[model samples]
Target: MADEEYISVEEVASIMGLSVRQASRYAAKVRTERINQRVLFHRDDVMEQARLKGIEHEARERAATYQPKPTKTDLVPAGEMLEYIRERDRQLAEVQAQLNQALLEIGRLQGQLTDHQQIRQQLTDIQSERDELKQAMERARPWWRRILGHD
Candidate 1:
């Protein structure tokens, strides 16, 4: 077989049917370190290690029973907390400003809609007044003339 190059921890896990953490531990046992936070393993080294560890039933059993411990870090200082709060407040203020602008635009549009409605109502009133004027003019005409005008 040809010499294989480097492979990622996830790739190794897929090949060995193991989890990424298990692959990481295997890589670490072989003194394989990550480069720039990217974990890579030599395929030959990984396969050799897997073959050697394959017959070790005790190691496999231990690995299956292993559990990672949780870590606790110190909380942020009061000053740092205040700074975070200030940053959050600034972001909220910016969002509120945008919301206010949107509301103002909505109000302007509503006013424009009201103006259009008022214009439409005025047009309807004008048409009614024109109709009434026509009716009044017809009524004021003499009855004999009105009868002849239609002919």
Candidate 2:
């Protein structure tokens, strides 16, 4: 036992190009010893088993397809992000100003419409009063004068 070398499960994982969990399962198929609540396997035995199972080829294939995640350094800087936000806010404010201008124009047009309606109503009232006064003047005039067609 002293002459032979023992490797930890983590070392077996690295050697087999497997994750720790996969390495643990693989180690169970071979001879394993528990020491200090940690599983240890003979490195030579683990490598031989991997060669027999053709796992080394699969590990190589997985590595070829692996892509690491992007880190914080890959992101846009804080100043650039703040500038983009400010630009968007400026565009939004311009749109809001145009909307407010349209609202003011609509209010002005509505005021003109109200003035036109009042003017129309006053014209109608004036026409009614003119008709009443004409009728009263006709009644006041003598019937003989109307027959003569004189004003």
Candidate 3:
């Protein structure tokens, strides 16, 4: 409050690990400023809140570099990974080929089905025509032939 310097809620949220809305709520009792629609609080007030929440502002220096000791089972060898990928790819290719063949077979079967349907329709038409012709012939027979049961 003495310095009158204001920090944006975004900085407070980053330092405190709280959301902007939460930081704004924490800064409610502090002096605030609005610049370009950003809610800002006095820098000292933000630091005071952080201190009261038991969060120290000090950065600890690491004494030594970190070395990971992962077990052998944790990592896969590059050669084995490559071989597995190749096998998966081979299986996928075989499946794709089979799928293509199946699609072709389906298309051929559909064509055959269409041909059979057309043949059935043609046979029906021919049978209907034959029946009509036989009826016409019966009508053309003379009365004497009809009485004698001759054609």
lDDT of 1 by residue, 1-151 (tens): 2223676676667556678887788766654546788867776676667678683454344435544333333366778889999999999999999999999999999999999999999999999999999999999988988999962
Candidate 3 lDDT tens digits, 25-134: 96677778877887778766766776777773530011022133455866888799899999999999999999999999999999999999999999999999999999
Cα lDDT tens digits for candidate 2, 76-143: 78899899999999999999999999999999999999999999999999999999999999999999
Off by over 4 Å in 1: 1-60, 63-94
lDDT of each: 0.73, 0.78, 0.74
Give all candidate RMSDs, comma-separated. Answer: 12.7, 9.5, 10.7
Error of 1 at 103 (Å): 0.1
Candidate 2 accuracy as TM-score: 0.48
lDDT of 1: 0.73
Q: How high is each candidate's TM-score?
A: 0.42, 0.48, 0.48
